[model samples]
Target: MWVCPGEADPELVRAGVALIADERGSVLVDAGQSPSHAREIQAALLAAGLPAPRWLVYTHHHWDHVWGACAWPDVEIVGHASGADLLRAEADRPWSVRYLREEVLRNRRLGPSFRARALAVDSWEELRILPPTRVFTDEVELPTGVLLRHVGGRHAPDSTVVVVPDSEVMLLGDSWYPPPAHLRTPADEPDLALVGRLLDDTIGWYVSSHSAPMTLDDARRAIAG
Candidate 1:
């Protein structure tokens, strides 16, 4: 099942979070934007009668994708090797400490309840960086049939993709998106060749973090035009 804020709300864009489950356990892909977001995810899991995730796989080290990971400190987090380094670097930055507070303030401008619900942090000190427990250079397979691959893209050096062959699902974390003028940049665009190759595979569902999930044919057309 996928857990997301639905549409692009002011507090957060359409960040996608997925839960892949099997008899062995469940894996959560991409922790959401804040602690409250994590709580939302937890509630969804409980409502669905699914077990708490045993593994957390990140697509990249972007703030939105990794910040809420601390909410699941006991889960075995996995991601690209470079992501681990980036997480450590980001945590060391002074601005990182202020991010949650700043976000809460920004949301407050939207509305008080929005601010309270979006961020549950009493102090920035509550925010802590939780690096991946297992970092892989290329690919690794979990017993549940989820494959994590380090598919670097223009978005981030540590961008990864989660593939579930049996389900014909491919979760592309901000790796590929319809080109927009404001976001267009030669240095930070997705790798078309890599995307084309993945699209050519057996994937039926193409899920992205900031956009609605698309069918394989729809993805191909989006890339073509």
Candidate 2:
């Protein structure tokens, strides 16, 4: 798991990134918020004696979970088919550097420290928006026990979950958590059954995109209500 020390602020949701590996190579669950965040992840991998990630599996199309993908030009990225479409659509929109700067300034939830670190971009050109190299509608298995499953919900139409069967861990990217009002659309709605299935005994650890890791029981209780 990748932890950014001194970066947590209650107002903001700090997503946790996970690394899955076997003899073949490493696979990153999320790319992080910026190129700097990707570098931090790279440093963590090096320190752990692991090689650079060969695969990057995104849980969704959120900027926090995908913007860092530009840093790994060679990594084979995988996500839901719709995620690729969304990325393409977003790239076509007016996401200029000035617009992003204004967004950073307007977000009060981002503490000064987080704003400083996440938006340390030198130029708008530095921002990289990449679509998935590989896309799947339901599930796909990699060399390791890694599995990517699409479980769209209110969070986003392209929401996905990464399951590492060997590790008994499931990475839920906003699948259960509600998206912010501005980000939500009229078509979005919760999928309680998906939450229950994800929390089932098959997954021992639940890694949420915006909260601390939760045990199976914790997830069960959280969804019970």
Among the numbered candidates, top TM-score falls to 2
**Candidate topping lDDT:** 1
> What are the per-residue Cα lDDT tens digits for candidate 1 across 105-126?
6654424423433344434555
Minimum summed lDDT over a 10-residue window in model 2 is located at 4-13
For each candidate, what is the lDDT?
0.74, 0.74
lDDT of 1: 0.74
Residues 1-225 of candidate 2: C-alpha lDDT, one tens digit per residue: 443322366333345677877787788888876777778778877888876778999888877778778887578999899889899986675566555557657875434434443454445567778889999999899887688888887677888988877788888877876664555566756555678976667778887776777899887777786
Candidate 1 C-alpha error for residue 131, in Å: 1.2
Error of 2 at 33 (Å): 0.6
Clashing pairs in 1: none
What RMSD does model 1 have? 5.0
